[model samples]
Target chain A: MDSTYINEIRRQFPILNQQVYGKPLVYLDNAATTQKPLCVIDRERDYYLHENCNIHRGVHYLSQMATEAYENARRTVAAFIHAAAPHDIVFTRGTTESLNLLASSLGQLLIEENDKVLISAMEHHSNLVPWQQMLRQKKGQLLVCPMDDNGVLDLQRYETLLDEKPRIVSIAHISNTLGTINPIKEMIGMAHKHGIPVIVDGAQSIAHHYIDVQSLDCDFFVFSGHKMYAPMGIGGLYGKSDWLEKMPPYQFGGEMVDQVSFEATTFNKLPFKFEAGTPNVGAALGLESAVRFIESLDRNQIEAYESALLQRAVEQLSEIEGLRFIGQAAKRSGLVSFVIDGIHPYDLGTIIDKMGVAVRTGHHCAEPVMTRFGIPGTVRASFALYNTMEEVDVFVKAVKKAAAMLR
Target chain B: MTIKEIQDAIVEDFSMFDDWMDRYAMLIEIGKECPLIDDKYRDDKHLINGCQSRVWLSAEMKDGKVYFAADSDAVITKGIIYLLIKVFSGQTPSDILDSDLGFLDKIGLKEHLSPTRSNGLLSMLKQMMLYAEAFKLQEDKK
Candidate 1:
């Protein structure tokens, strides 16, 4: 991508034009959460200013408008991921909540004593803890798919683990800490051969690449919108209708129930049965606007631009003495995690922040990955569509300066 | 010296630095010189849990005054802990408990004290106070 196009894209995010600690802010924390664009902000504000009312069962015009907007957001999410039906998309607070919902609902439906759930070593805690808790409750076992030192998942070992006949396979589409892009399409195929279901944690991958649930043929996929320039507290889960129909409701409340009698209550249909509350109508609208913003751009160009940013970071940062990258996967996303010989990640991060660079430091909620690598933590710099090559240069300079000070 | 006198001296020392680089450089020097906790107490038992870095703190009562030894994986955090120890060590439990840590802000290192920073300075200070309170309770029992 050209500089002019990149600059135009940067202009849409109003937060980018600011200074931090007497320096222009260089935000490389997109893996944590992305800065919102003006359109997404406006869409959310417009909902509250114009159509602020309860969704679903309401007779008033404002209520109907709000309900239409919320449902439309659901449909937009469905189309974004290429789900078979709008009902397959369930609105969630974010990826963590979506995974927890699956763990709870699916555990009740599918998990039995001695059953197994397989997950990759590179999964973030959101994907790891939920399944561990679920399996513990069901008296089932949790099998881990190992990764090599380069952070690539071992396909041979993963294939071998599949012979254990795990009830489900939960894996990250892209690792938040390592940035390894797991071959979930092939992993799903292998799991399906053994009649095992798979859940793809697309929290990191959804913003970086296009997703087609039908093509992947995975049982379920989950992602958060905030990482893609939407407001927080809004995300989605796309599950196959066959599985969703059989699963129980995740929460019990007003919207999820059809009829609440003295003795028992009948739950609502596919998406509603999972929602269970008044819902975040404004954030849902913001998420839809973010999806539209991404669709408006040339996705292929954006992907290529981000990959270049990651490459630039790797090449430049590798020149620094004593700095070692943690994850060097053959197939990776637009992030890099590394540690210096003697300097701790927290110390480096603190100094880097003084230079107006925002990067994530520490285990990134992937303590298992840290243990696997035999390190305390790593400093991760993640790139996004709006991140510029110039910003990457600034980040590299900041890291170099911080390393000098620490050394 | 009393805790107040020591904190005042630290504030005066830090006042010489005009920018963050000098301030952090001094902190890094202090970290290098900071007394480390014995390896025996450096396990999970003495570990301060909240900070992004691993911090080990141990305290003992000598002649009715508390002395502390602490260590951290991060140099900046260790330096901050050294500062905390300088202020509170060799002080009576009551004096340590009664002391205020507003000197952290006066030294322009207030950001480290923020809970969001996750550097464990705040947790370290709290742990020190708890150690003093425990010693006081034991004295009361005696």
Candidate 2:
């Protein structure tokens, strides 16, 4: 918990450096929301100070400049996911809002009574609940595709459900709780064969690895900016241009309107139709900065370094008596999750936090996945770019000490 | 109920549920306070099926106060409903709409909710607001 790299990154985040419970903070809650880099923090401050103006409608220079900067962020985001067109990237409040937008609009058009909506057990609630709410409204059946012992999607069971060919199948690109990187390319291909549109909840994966929309061919994809070193309340929904063109506007308000009459109002085209309000201009700029930051860093180097770190973690954690790693997927993105026998996750998390090593506790918005494992929750340590082997060692020692006290 | 009574209830009653052990006990007690939902309400029509724990919510209006009764198969979630009810219950429509429970972050435990559970809590709050909106409409018509 006292490692220099940890201390360095800790210093970078003014929020992270502050004492919690009379101890220096150890933040492992990156899976929930990441601490911003100084660059990201500065960019947000700089935006409000310099580039603060309402976009699209302003005739003045600042408004036009503001509009350009915002849309330029849109292009950077589109390029990040390898989307075909920039307009395919519709800015949203966050992954939750993005998913709900899809669920409410396309869900209304597609879902029906007893029509099955398929999702894997590993989905974050953000990915699952929108479909469930939509299915409930439509009197549709919600079906979960089972996972095997390793928490990988059970292809056999997936095929079984694929026979019903759910109207919509939503899956996470990576499991936030288990760190299971789902085999989404194959899953998407199989789903498309059955005419089921797949939405990849890329909230956890986007920061860790590369995502090419054309290669994966998922109909809808979502991720939050806050998870990827950007500010919160900004995310994007990537739907095929054609589908977005057809789907109804999620919220009725300014900017989405084409023409407003007393009788009926026409909506704007693909993205503006979905982006209903004033939008997060500052956060979007910060997200664009995040995209640039990730792009500028050597991604392959980061991946290799992260993989080695994860491998070392697995080896070390497995050595702890009664410690079991969930979903050792052999393919995870910059993360590892595990549980210690006879230690409640909450207790483990609190004790570790006291020693200044932060890790996520409880069901990680994927309680069904926790239920599948027959555990209340796990202590999840998710990694990011700034993390180092020394920090991991500190975390490991703290976990070992915590286990000795509790277990 | 006066705002001061509510302010006091929130300041005191919810603070005691901070420890998960105490939290669970408090939740179980809240379950005791909540009337048992009818079997008819357990169907897909009323069942909030997304929750990892089974949750049933039923609302009724007797006089002016809108009574909310919720039970969750998960013990902790039922307690979550209790915390929710403390803010939500016995409030006027406009007041309920305007109130920001952001102070929950300062107290902590709202983050204890898994993201899905957080959403379920949010949906429950939204549903409560919707209920208030509907009640206001009905009152206007009368």
Candidate 3:
């Protein structure tokens, strides 16, 4: 891609053309949540301004149009993830809710006393806590597959942990704090061999690269739209037909009911069975727009550009004295997390913010990952497609100054 | 000077620094000047939770005035607590209770503190007020 293409992409995101603390903003907090582009924002606004209505129930024109747009958004997500059918997709509040729905429903379906649920140590709290609570309720064991010193999942230990025959295996596609991209294909295959289903938390991975649920062959996959430049409060969960067929509906309400009688109520079909009550129609349209935006940009080019940006960030940030990166995984994604000696991540983060560089401090919602590494937290700089090398230079200079001040 | 006068003085001092870096350096110096908490009072009972960094606060009443001592693991948090102690310590319980603490906003200190750190600052302030309220109750009983 040329500078013109990159600049055009940057122009679409209006939030980037601003200042913070009297300095030009260099937003490197994409891993937390991405800023929306004009198209996604406008699409959501258009839904409210022109097409606003409760979906799936009304007889009026606005309702029909909204239902079509809402269902079409499901199809867009289904196509984006290459699911077998739009019926395989379920609308969710976000990745956290999706994981909770799965854990609760799947736990009820699969987990019994003494059954095990295996998760890696690198998972965010969203992916970890539900299983822990579910297993505790079921009197089942929640086994943690340890990660190596460098933040790579210890496959040897995972293989051993699988010997216990966990009811299901859940893992992250990418570590939010460490940026370790797990070998999902091989891990899924390994779990499948043991007759266990796997759920891949793609909250971090979905924004960075292509994901095909059918290709990955995992029983389920979950992601948040806000992490990918869509509006917040919209996400999707893609479950294989077999799992969705077997599992009970996560929530019971209107539209998820096939027939409501005074005596007994039968539930609705596949995707609707999970989504309860009135959905986020505007957010769904925004998510569809975000998906269209990604499709407009070549996935291969986005991946390559992000990889190069990460390289530049790593190279530049490594030059700072006493700065040590948390995760030194061989394969990583579009983020770099580090801690400087004699400076708290909070202090470093505060100083950097004053210079108008937006980075995430603290545990990044993966307190377990920090516990595994025996550190309080790390300062993370996550890059998105709009990020330029010039912004990285500003971040590096600001970080160097921050380190000097704190130390 | 009164507690409000001291806070006004601190706010005026912070106003001299146009940049955050200079303000932070001055704040760190204020933290360095904070009197250390006694080892006996450094136990978990006196320790304030909810702080991203560990903080221990000790309060004592002598001649109807409340004296406070504090320590923190983080420099910035320590500095914030030190600033808080400067305004609250050596004041009567009633005087401490009536304090508005608007100087924090005037200096932009509250906004400058990160979310977690600001929560910690609030936790510290609450503990101080609780101490003041408790001393006030003791005096009432007497």
Candidate 4:
């Protein structure tokens, strides 16, 4: 709650202390990917330095050790998300890969002709495109759950959309672009009554909030480790164990096989069936360390801090002439996406970068959202556990300076 | 590999019939760096859909190799096409057909371009690849 507490947290991220464009960096792109905590970096380094070896099918001690660690990492991630079983969790490359795996493996199995796949209008392209492809391939329909004027999903209309009894309703638990945390638990509950399976894209929410798959009753949940202060190229998909057991293997070869013969090949079971080839072991290890780091912090306090920061950010940014919030929902995580008056977001981004502030400037991989808003793109500042009010002040000053230059 | 080689190709070959500034600017920025398409060809038919900028691309084959000419209204967007041209232009139809244009990350301009910019580039590249394959198919028929 104190300013000093945030500064202390900032000290954990080594990169934040550096100079960019002759000014101290103010990183607010945590929604895209949070900076790696020192523990995660060290854990990853320690793995490569001390215990680097190919996991599975190795008789050597190092191999056994590496395998133990990697599987332990899997267990940690599974426990973090409160999955019923570790076997239900499939380690993936990232959220995109996880979503695509679900679409390719599960969506293909479930979605037949005329079966509707429902998604929110505020979904990131990763959540949108793969299901869209499935819809195109299977002659199915992709129905968008409508949003209110404030960019929040319309619950009444959502119930109306659910009247169609969609085969699958995949929605982001928290919107990456807008930072609106959907009423996922309620949505999932409603979908279950209709016997519709739901996939929760937890890419934005998993890092900031507590996620209990059992409590939410989501059929499938996916998130990227990188977004949660782990290394890139590693994420996970948590599915109900029974559903995972029933789905067909996504990619064949390497670890995901029971036996291989010239005549016939038998696929492996559950998580292994989806995960093929050499996994990103080092990154997975880093994710385990990231979970450990999260456990050390008062997650509730961090969320409160970030929320307070978001309030400050919105209040400060709105004070600037011609600036407008794109997604001002009643509830949000730590983000404020806006477009400056008459100035292109790219130009705004370029100038803000000049002031040593790092914020995402583009469609945020949700062009449909941009199209919905009738804007080219938005400049978004997403807060993390470490972001301070001082840095936010700096960001505010820089945005004002950038806007002045344009004026 | 070098700027000189690219510039030489740009100067010595000018029959592509596109403008020097308005058309060539966008292509060179995205790094496709192709020659220009004539104004006569710049109709709605040639317009690249889904691009933030207006883009036009035309392709022709001569002596079993494919030549592409592209133009865009956005400055950096042209650089994308120019980069593609540097890698893809003047290649044989068979070679173009065999190559994987998905080496986008290796070329290292991916993170620089926004998602929409990259998507536009993808749509344009996909169309060009389709055109090249069509040429390859035609040549095979011959």
Judging by TM-score against the true structure, name the best candidate. Answer: 1
Model 4 ranges with Cα > 4 A deviation? B1-142
lDDT for position B107 in model 1: 87
Sorted by DockQ, highest first, which candidate order results?
1, 3, 4, 2
Task: For model 4, report the TM-score of its A chain.
Answer: 0.98
Model 4 lDDT per residue over A19-93, tens place: 974678889999988999899999999999999998987999999999999999989999999999888899999
Provide TM-scores for the models.
0.99, 0.74, 0.97, 0.78
Worst 10 residues of 2 chain A by lDDT: A1-10
Looking at model 1 chain A, which ten-residue stretch has the lowest summed lDDT? A130-139
Q: What is the per-residue lDDT of model 1 for residues A147-239, given as tens digits with 9 covering 90 to 100?
A: 999999999999999999898899999999999999999999999999999999999999989999999999999999999899999999999
- Scanning candidate 3 chain A in windows of ten residues, the lowest lDDT window is A342-351
Model 1 segments more than 4 A misplaced? none
How many backbone clashes are present in model 4?
26
lDDT of 2 by residue, A1-407 (tens): 23464446546667765676566565667888887878788888998898899998999998998999999999999999999999999999889999999889988778878888899888888888888888888899888998887878888899889998688888888889878888999999999988888888999888889999978999999999999999999988999988888888889997999999999999988688888889999999999998887887668877777777777777788879999987877677667888887666655675577577888777887888888998867889888766667667878888898777554
TM-score of chain B, per candidate?
A: 0.94, 0.71, 0.90, 0.67
Candidate 3 residue-wise lDDT, B1-142, digit = tens:
6999999999999999987789988876676566568788889888776435667898999999999998876677788888888898899999999999789888878764445554366777888999999999998889
- Interface RMSD values for the candidates, listed in order? 1.0, 6.7, 1.8, 6.0
RMSD in angstroms between candidate 3 and the native structure over all alpha carbons: 1.6
What DockQ class does candidate 4 belong to?
A: incorrect
DockQ, per-model, please?
0.79, 0.05, 0.48, 0.06
Looking at model 3, how many pairs of residues clash? Answer: 0
lDDT of 1: 0.93
